[model samples]
Target: MPSMRTRPSRIVLIALLVVAALVLVAVVAVSAPILLHRSAGGSGQEIPASAVPETTARGADGRVRTLSAHDGDGPADLGAVAPGETLRIDGSGFDAGIGIYVAVCAIPASSEEKPGPCLGGIPEGAESGTVDESRLTSAWVTNDWAWRSFATHQYSDASEGSFSVTLTMPEPASTGLDCRETRCAIATRADHTAGSDRVQDMLLPAVYE
Candidate 1:
């Protein structure tokens, strides 16, 4: 019952509305993949001042760098570490600060691989800190993970997103045991002053120091 002029106008309006709805659906379909990617990979997490990622991670520092523990005699080879040698940690994603660390533990002499069996991950907890005390009652541990920090360079120096730090390897006496002449597992950590100082506490177990 509408006029001819208004009937044509309504038809045009309906066609425009249909086109708009189609455009909106196309936009959402195109963007759904991007949204899913961001959800799965995260939007690049911020690297806290001193806190390292929970797992072996590239973090924000850049590509994942190999963290090797050696006394300079051709890499640790994941075997018996030499005594009285300075440990050099070269890698990426290490935050800059004076509290860089190298934590060592004697792996089970049995045929277990590094970081397996009696040897667990260092900086061992939800946050970056010493291994869980309640879990390390029997494992051979160090008196202090942070012994000789020799980091003069800041992580910011790595404009290319790489960083390195070196610490003097713990001695036999440092582990509160005669582990100097044994094969060990090494884990790197940092002070992360931006985090909690309580995590920096390096003490012995079952025996107060």
Candidate 2:
């Protein structure tokens, strides 16, 4: 019963509605993972303990870097992290001019091998300026233009390139490596901006029970 003029308008309206729905779906798909991470807990809470061990690595430039782990109360041992628990990692003596990625990864067969595939992957919020602390499993640190323009508020360091971040322990299955059976590590490496650079590479060995 609709006339030609009304029929065209109805078609256009339906097309617009479909486009809107698709956009919504895309937004949901992108946001769902971040939301799930945030809900997993362990963000800004203090690590549980009083003393933790520090691991150090020397870069090609002769500069030294360090990583320390902490549970919710205080310092914790890297060799005894609980699966699914939260940990705070602290870093120091890094190169401020270069960007780096801090993540939990499987230990390489040898020092020359690269570390990966890391747990929690890269955060979507890193691309944007907004970072959800509760969902911080892996972190990118840099003073580069992209970081300054986008992720400046998320993580940074002093002029000395010292920084700290917190992450939730991923299950052994998620890493595709049974950390209970094999060794894993909390590691740092050059970010994608300098993917092949190993000057910043470092590892703090870890084991989960």
Candidate 3:
């Protein structure tokens, strides 16, 4: 009993509803994994696992420069890994008799500029500025000379010889980082020992387990 004018209006309304539903589904599909990504702890909680938790960009030289593992030891020290793979740290010369900080920092494969910390869970718009690290549950800490300057949780009794730090690399989808970004494993002595901070930083390239 509807006239031609009403018929057209109803059709438009139905079409609009379909479009809205599609858009919602698309958004959810993209965000589901990120929303579910796991962290060593919950918000505002200190996640010290004894555990837990990009890709590539080049320099201007027309040559692609990649930073693999940088442990003073050798390449074999920092082996390659894949998404969701568990990385084993053979704490050979790291530290002993003291606590240490262990973490994994990653860059997404889609980043263009120099890759930096994996800063997930940071406040929106914080990346452009210094988002309080305490607020960022996913920032990667570098195990350089001053590495300790940035750690929150300290795992005691890190490997000096046979002890090891084991961590599972976060899956790209869960990390909300681009698939190609590089990931680095950093372990620094919690307290100064042997007159040195004794830092261990290694870059991990993708090579699936």
Q: What is the C-alpha lDDT of each candidate?
A: 0.35, 0.66, 0.35
Off by over 4 Å in 3: 1-80, 106-162, 173-179, 182-209
Candidate 3 positional error at 127, Å: 26
Query: How well does model 1 score by local distance difference test?
Result: 0.35
What TM-scores do the predictions have?
0.33, 0.67, 0.29
Candidate 3 residue-wise lDDT, 1-209, digit = tens: 77889988999999999999999988775455345533221111111222222112222222221222332344333334454444444333322333333334452233222223442232333335443533323332223222334433222233322234444445444344443443533322222222122122223433223
Top model by TM-score, which number?
Answer: 2
Displacement of residue 102 (Cα, Å) in model 3 is: 2.8
Model 3, poorest ten-residue lDDT window? Answer: 40-49
Candidate 2 TM-score, C-alpha based: 0.67
Ranking by TM-score: 2, 1, 3
Residue 197, candidate 1: Cα error in Å is: 10
lDDT of 2 by residue, 12-48 (tens): 9999999999999987764553344211111111222
Which regions in candidate 2 have their CA more than 4 angstroms from the true location?
1-52, 149-158
Worst 10 residues of 2 by lDDT: 38-47
